[model samples]
Target: MSDPKTEEDIFAEVDAEIAAEEEAAAAEMDEPIGPSDSAVDGPGAGVDALVAERDELQDRLMRALAEAENIRKRGERDRREAEQYGGSKLARDMLPVFDNLRRALDAIDEPSRDVAGGVIEGVELTLRELLNVFGKHGIRPIAPEVGDVFDPQLHQAMFEAPVPNVPKGCIVQVMVEGFELHDRLLRPAQVGVSSTPAS
Candidate 1:
């Protein structure tokens, strides 16, 4: 007893429903997915994270290597310094004995030298032996005498004296000798420097 619907009306309704469904599906796909979505997970995501981790680890490794190299260099410098200055105090104490030996040899008179030949020979031999010991331990003496140029780096002026024939600022007399170890001055020579004579 009911009348049949026209084909055009049925077709229009079905087409409208299909269009709405298609639009809704497109909006859902365009929306940004949050962490709740399982779409951006799996082996590909794990590979990317691993690549970032590897880069950070490589950077840390390079820094660690640089720090280690710096420590090694510092240790080497400390060791060299220790070796160079280890016996400085002992060497300084032995200098007075050498000075006494030199003074004893200087005090002997030329007239009495023949009578005390054995004593003079013993003293000379002892001085040579002491010098040999100094050479063995890298402790050498510097004996800059009068008429030498006054070197502030190796000599300490005790007084200035006017002396003829010697250039001004030259050494007039050496009061005490200097000493060096490995090119470094352990003690500066005590000296008298020359000045121009008064008119």
Candidate 2:
């Protein structure tokens, strides 16, 4: 209180305070900031994590695409099958009508045919038209001839007979013709098979 401070002393004290602040700031910058090891590896770790995430997302995308493709193919196959086999039941139900028509034709004798020529001709024309329609619709008859080799896939054995000069497993008689729609068998031919061995 007795001595008054001069301007120089005041200026020197201000300079000393600023110097101390600068020294403190410099010391803080020189020291390691945050965790030293983590700071060194942070960028690489971040890049690695991003790459792994990208790979995982890519894998998921590929699996989803593959599943979608499989579903599409399966749907296409189902549609094609539906289109090809849609009328199988109707085609099968009409077979008995065709068989009855054939039986009617077979039952007529020569005398009846001569007496009712016009009526017989009408029936024959109707039968032929029916066969033409069947041909148009991919329906074909499997008519197995007598003495042909019997095939279980296409023929149903109605009876077995032992006839002379007939080979075993050969067809001796055809009872009824089979029918097919496209590549599918609508009915198997009924036949009599020979049980006699070849001479």
Candidate 3:
């Protein structure tokens, strides 16, 4: 009563059954494994956690090294600054003594100059020794002489004096000698600037 199937039909049916069986087997194999089947947590998971911890520790170590380098650079800068300006207060205090020495030298006049020669020589020698000491410490005097052009940066004009021979704005007198430490002016020279003679 049933009709005989063709070869093509038989082959198609067999292929379909085979394909269905293969798909079912693949699905079974792809199913998620239970915790019991998984060996990850049983053996190598602790090693993976330790690796992660090592990476974090390495990051922290690099940050700490950078911070230490910054601190070292800051300390070096502070030390250099301290060395450069260490004697500022002492230099300021010694300025009055230099002024006194200059005043003593100026007090000796022509008539009394012969009588005060020995005292003046001693004072001059003391001043020269003091200046030598300053030179050793990188301090230099900046006293502008008469007929020198007035410079506002180095000279502070106390007053303007009329002098016939010198040009206007020229330095006529130095009231106090200035000083420099390295390239920076520690004090400006106190000076009397010359003006045109009164008409």
Candidate 4:
């Protein structure tokens, strides 16, 4: 059989339970609150980390944009060059034909021209048309004449000779005219340079 509980015993038991709960709460309060020590260095550390990450990303973005701009510029330059001088090889091949036509005209004497006047007229017309087409395509002649100063950029010396009254480094004779495609030289004019010294 169980004995009945006294009022004083019950009160004492309740006081002990209350004390245990208070002790537990006090222990919790004494310990650190929020994140643990290993989780973060200090206040504002997380913000600094985020700012560094943002700066790195921004730098990468700028570099990417700059590279893209350079690629675009290079492509544009290539396209312009293609447009301006794409048929340079064909133009160069056709030069011999022009030379032949000019030779034909030059070889025709007055009597031969009188005998084949129609054929001569046709050749002249053909030559004129060929020149017109060349002009339209930005292909032009670099015609160096005698007495002009020899320029390595536009003239190729076929021979060097000492001539009277001609200054040194001057073009004594022109063998073949040069041609250019746009701003680029397709060929330099073949010339004879004088090696005469100034007296």
The global C-alpha lDDT for each of the candidates, from Candidate 1 onward, is 0.78, 0.81, 0.80, 0.83
For this target, which candidate reaches the highest lDDT against the unseen true structure?
A: 4
Better of 1 and 3 by TM-score: 1
Sort all candidates by lDDT, best to worst: 4, 2, 3, 1
Q: Which lDDT tens digits does candidate 3 get at residues 6-82?
A: 54565566556555655664565467867775554444454455456555755675686679789999999999877
| lDDT at position 127, candidate 3 | 94
Per residue, candidate 2 scores C-alpha lDDT tens digits across 1-199 of: 5686654565565556555655665565566767875567553454455456556755675686679789999999999878777777988888888888888889999999989999889888988898898788888899999989999989999999888888899999998889888888989999999996645
**Better candidate by TM-score, 2 or 4:** 4
The TM-scores, one per candidate, come to 0.73, 0.74, 0.64, 0.75
How close to the true structure is residue 169 of candidate 4, measured as C-alpha lDDT? 97
lDDT for position 72 in model 3: 95
Tens digits of per-residue lDDT for model 1 on 1-199? 8775554554565556555655665566566767766465632454455446555755675686679789999999999977987777888898888888889899999876989989988988998998898788788888887788989998999999888776789988887888888778889999999988655
The prediction achieving the highest TM-score against the true structure is: 4
Which runs of model 2 end up more than 4 angstroms from their true locations? 1-41, 197-199
Deviation in Å, model 4, residue 100 alpha carbon: 1.2
What are the runs in model 3 whose C-alpha is more than 4 Å off?
A: 1-56, 160-169, 194-199
- Model 1 gets an lDDT of 0.78
Report residue 34 deviation for candidate 2 (angstroms). 4.2
TM-score of model number 1: 0.73
In Å, residue 2's CA in model 2 sits off its true spot by 93
- lDDT for 27 in candidate 2 is 62
